[model samples]
Target chain A: MILDLIQNSFDGLAMGASYALLAVGFTLVFGVLRRVNLSYGPAIMFGCYAATWVSFSFHSNIFLLLGIAVLGSVLAGTYVERLCFAPHHKGSAIAAMVASFALWMQFEEVVTLVMPKHLYDFPPMFDAEPLAIGPLSLRAEALVMLACALAICFALHRMLYRSRFGLALRAVTDAPVAAQLAGINVPRVLLLVFLLASAIGGLAGWLIVSTHTQVTPMLGMWSTLKGLLAMMIGGLGSLPGAVIGGLALGVLEAHSQWFLGPQARDLIAYLLLFVLLAWRPRWMTTSHG
Target chain B: MTALLEVRDLVTAYGKIEALKGVNLDVQQGSITCLLGPNGAGKTTLMMTIAGILRPRIGSIRFAGEEIAGRPPHAIVAGGAALVPENRLVFPNMTVLDNLHAGAYQRKDDFASDIERLFTRFPRLKERSTQLAGTLSGGEQQMLAVARALMSRPKLLLMDEPSLGLAPLVVEEIFRIITQLHQDGVSIFLVEQNAHMALKVAQHFYLMEQGKVTFSGTPGALAEDEVIRRAYLGSARA
Candidate 1:
């Protein structure tokens, strides 16, 4: 029983890592652009589809497929920035948000029309066997996801704190008019942020697909809501808040499955989110920028 | 010295309300010029229009003989003009050091030495290099703002209300810094509320009311004018 409990905890943590990635992407985009990218979910789903097709067509390695997925998402984000967001940039925030919803629906429908609705199971990225380490058992794919999430977080922190580009991005996020006068291109920095966020989302899709061995049209829909919730519960636009909130949600969610049963887990997640929001109304508008 | 900045009948507006009405001005190289007036004088509007933060409704602004009225603020800075905007618009979340770095954002050259120079000049900033700018005293934040603008290595620095809400000692320090910069051969365009401080620092001054340049003269000449005395100094003692 103790062994199972420990295994469950590891599983919870690994799952939380994925949520951490999703929440980071969501919060980063919102922090800079001040508009949530609803298209992110459909973009993630399409990226998964592209990854599956690449692996199937060329019999390429999982790592290569992961690279393609990330690249595809980056391109998608750029296209969205150029065609949709930048032009409407000076307009109302709600207009940009509604436009994102339209883009999301359009991408989702287009991908569905092109691909089969039935699940296309992907092969396990690593050896099918789970590793037993003391009291904990962890799948290789979960381990890889956890490492990738941690590495990405660490790299981002360093980039934000150490690099020139990161400084300009932060300045633009904080006070755009002052940033402009200081010679930072506010729009260009925001575009780069969107690209980074989409790439992270694409990597998340690839990881989720690897673990589940399944790809569906709606794969990212639930994760998108969860990501938004995590961002809100933490603090909108704060990097640390997103990471903490994501990890907390992941652990609570995993344990809910063990304690309350799988069917009612989502209700518990929502309840916790509600409780957090009830306690901290200011979290909704908080941003380090 | 040649004119470093030239504005020809510049007109700017907020929708239907015209704020800058055919205003013209010239700032000579290596001098401190002040624009002074009562509230609603459009002094801040002119500054914003010149800095490319707001597009002028009409007229032209030339910086170092290049047309820069319609360019974005970043491009305008890249052309060697920087504005320390009204209210000391410091990035509140950033540390003093970070704010200084941000001021040099457009320059590809190294800023470490310049930053060191600034820290050396303002030991208070050096003492609190890592403290968030919002936490700084109002005077410290204003100093940080000026230091940040200097990081751009601007040929012309436009300071809007640098002395606003500052303590008398702090205001004196700011004026001293302005004089030091002027002595160091940096051109300054000052928008000021304290007429006495402006007279002390400026080589030339313009008085504006209702978006028009009502008077322009040397401080000594303005002090002697009867009309200017009644309007600005409120009955100048003969």
Candidate 2:
């Protein structure tokens, strides 16, 4: 029982790390713009799809595929920003979100049109067997995922706190008018942050798809749901909180799936969100930005 | 002396509701100019318009002989005018030092000495330089706001409601700093609700009513006008 708990904990945390990366990207955009990009997951899916298509037509290295995934997501993100977020910035936030959802449909259809297959195989990160500790086993890919998430979080923290651009970004996040008066170009900051978040989402998507060694149309909705869930669980618009929330969610889901079942896993995860919303609405609703 | 900041026939609006209707105002070099008005009189609107945060529908804003009517806020700040916005909107999450750094974001020069100078001017900000702006007390936040704007190295400083919410002693301290800044040759265009405090420091006063300049005079003239005194120093003053 003890060994099982330890093993489950490690697997849960590894899964949580991926969710944390997704959450971080979501939180960055939300933090600065104070708007949800509903197309976030779809954008990532678009990149993964681009790579999958590339793989079918040509034999490219996995690392090159990863680059294509990130680039494609960023390009999709730029589309969403220009067509949705930019014009609606000073306008209604609901309008922007609705427009983003509309584009989410566009992304889904575009991917489906090019690649009608419901599922496709992707190049995996490694063919190595799971690494074993004395009593527990861990996937090498999971370790990479965990390490990348932590490293990205640390780098982001440093960039935000240590660099001039970060200072201006935080200033813009704090109060946009004051930032403008202080001579920070508020619009440029918004665009840069959105692109940065999109790129991060793309990287997360590449990692997840490689781990599963499979791709599906559902990846868009799945990535979006998981990212949104983790962001809310951590606390809205907090970097560190998003990561913690992601991990907590992963552990909770892992334990529930282990003890109860798969359906119970999703149910308990959502139930926690519902309870959190009901008990402390502020945590879920407040935009820390 | 030449005007450091000038506004001629400025008309600004929110949709069709004209907030500042053909207003004419100017701040002389090295003078503390105060704008007094009731809640809906558009005092803040005029300040925002002048600062380039809000564009004027029709008129001219010439700062230091440059036409800056339609320019962006950062360009205005870059051209040597900084607005210490209303209610002390400091970057609450950032440290005081970071907030100061944000002020100099437009400048390419080294502002180490300027930061040191601001610390000397607002000692409380120095004591809490590493602390977040949100954690500071109301007065300290106000000082930080002032210091943050000063980081831009403006010749003309536009301050809106600096004494809006603060203790009596803190207000006095703010006024003292304003007086000292004027003596140091920075032109100040001030918006104040405190007529009594404003009358003390301001050499020139403009009274705004329903988005137009109703009265422009000395402190004595401001006090002597029956309509102006009753409206400005009436229920709102208390």
Candidate 3:
């Protein structure tokens, strides 16, 4: 039983890493601007489609596909800002949220119209062989996803704390008015943030698509929802919280899958979410420390 | 040489009600100019207009021989003007260091030494560099606001009521800093309700009433008039 639990936990880690990346992306944009990017789900789905297409065209170098997907996300993010978010920045935040949701629906419909709803095979460059060491076994793809997630997190940490752009971003996020008085172009900073976050989302979509070896238009709705829940569970605007929340939810779902079947996995997630809501840290409940 | 800031026939309004009605003023280069007024006398509106936060309906603002009447706030800062807005508008969630860094947002050059200079000037800021501006006391936040504005190394510092809501001791400390900065050759455009403090610090003064400059003079002239005493000190002439 213990061995099974251990194996499940490792499998959970792989799932957790992908969710964590998505959570980080969502949290980064939401925490700074205080608006939900509903279109984020479609953006992720589009990223997966784009990554797979690039891999097929460019001869299956996983690294190249990942790079291409991230670039696609960045471009998509910029396009959203220019077309949807920027014009409404001064009007109403709710309007921006509605626009994002509208865009998401539009993109999903477009994708559905373009491609069939059925999942298509997408084989990546990574070997799918399971490595057994002692009494534990782990999939190579899962380990790769976990490593990439950790690396991205580390890079983000450095960017936020050590770089000039990070300093400007933090200033604007903390107080946009203050930042403006200090002469930082707030709109520009916000757009850059959108681009960076979407790129991260793209990378996450790539990771998940590669592992699952399939693509579907509805992939975004499920993953982005999980990311949002994880962000809320961890603490809104808390980067570390997003990661911890994602991992916990992933592990809980895995255990549920092991014991009560695949259908019970989402039920377990909601249960844990309820528990977290009930026992959320008092200081964190207010959000933003 | 022209004044550091020149405002001519400036008019600003909120929706329908005009706040500043065709006001004209010129702040001499490198001089500490004070604008005095009662509450709702359009002092803040004028400051906001000059700082490029508010666009006047009609006016020409010449800063250092260039027109900046309708320029954006960031552009104004880029042209060497920075404002320390009313009520100590420091970024509360951000640390003191971060707030100060935000101050230099327009400046693209290396700013490490400038930050160090600010720390040397305000040791308290250096002590609580990592502490959030919101957590600081009112006086400390005010100091942070001023320090943050200075981080831009602005040629003309537009301060809107820096002495509001503080203990007498803190008020005095703020005045001392103002004096020190003035001595260091920084041009100051001050708006305040504290008549006594404003009188002491100003080289040239403007008295705003009902959205117009009712009086403009040196400090000595304003102190000599009985009507001025009644209006400023709120005391009836003997």
Best by TM-score: 2
Q: Write the residue-wise lDDT of candidate 2 on A1-289 in tens digits.
A: 9887888888899889989999999999988888999999999999999999898898658888999999999999999999999898678999999999999999999999999989999999999999888878899988998998989999999999898889878998888899999988888888999899989999999999999999998999998999999999988988888999899998899999999988899899999989887886665666474
DockQ of each: 0.70, 0.74, 0.69
Candidate No. with top lDDT: 2
Per candidate, native contacts kept equal 0.75, 0.88, 0.83
Would candidate 1 be rated incorrect, acceptable, medium or high by CAPRI criteria?
medium
Best by DockQ: 2
Pairs in clash, predicted candidate 2: none
lDDT of 2 by residue, B36-116 (tens): 877878988988888888888999999999999988888899999999989999999888999999999988899999999
**Per-candidate alpha-carbon RMSD to the true structure:** 2.9, 2.4, 3.1
lDDT of 3 by residue, B1-238 (tens): 4599998989999989999998989899888999887778789999988887788999789999999998878899999989999999898887898888778766779999988988998999999999988999999999999999998898999999998999999999998999899999899999987778877888988877777877788887735354245345543321
- The weakest ten consecutive residues by lDDT in model 2 chain B span B229-238
- Chain B TM-score, candidates in order: 0.94, 0.94, 0.94
**TM-score (chain A only) of candidate 1:** 0.94
Q: Which candidate do you rate higher for TM-score, 1 or 2?
A: 2
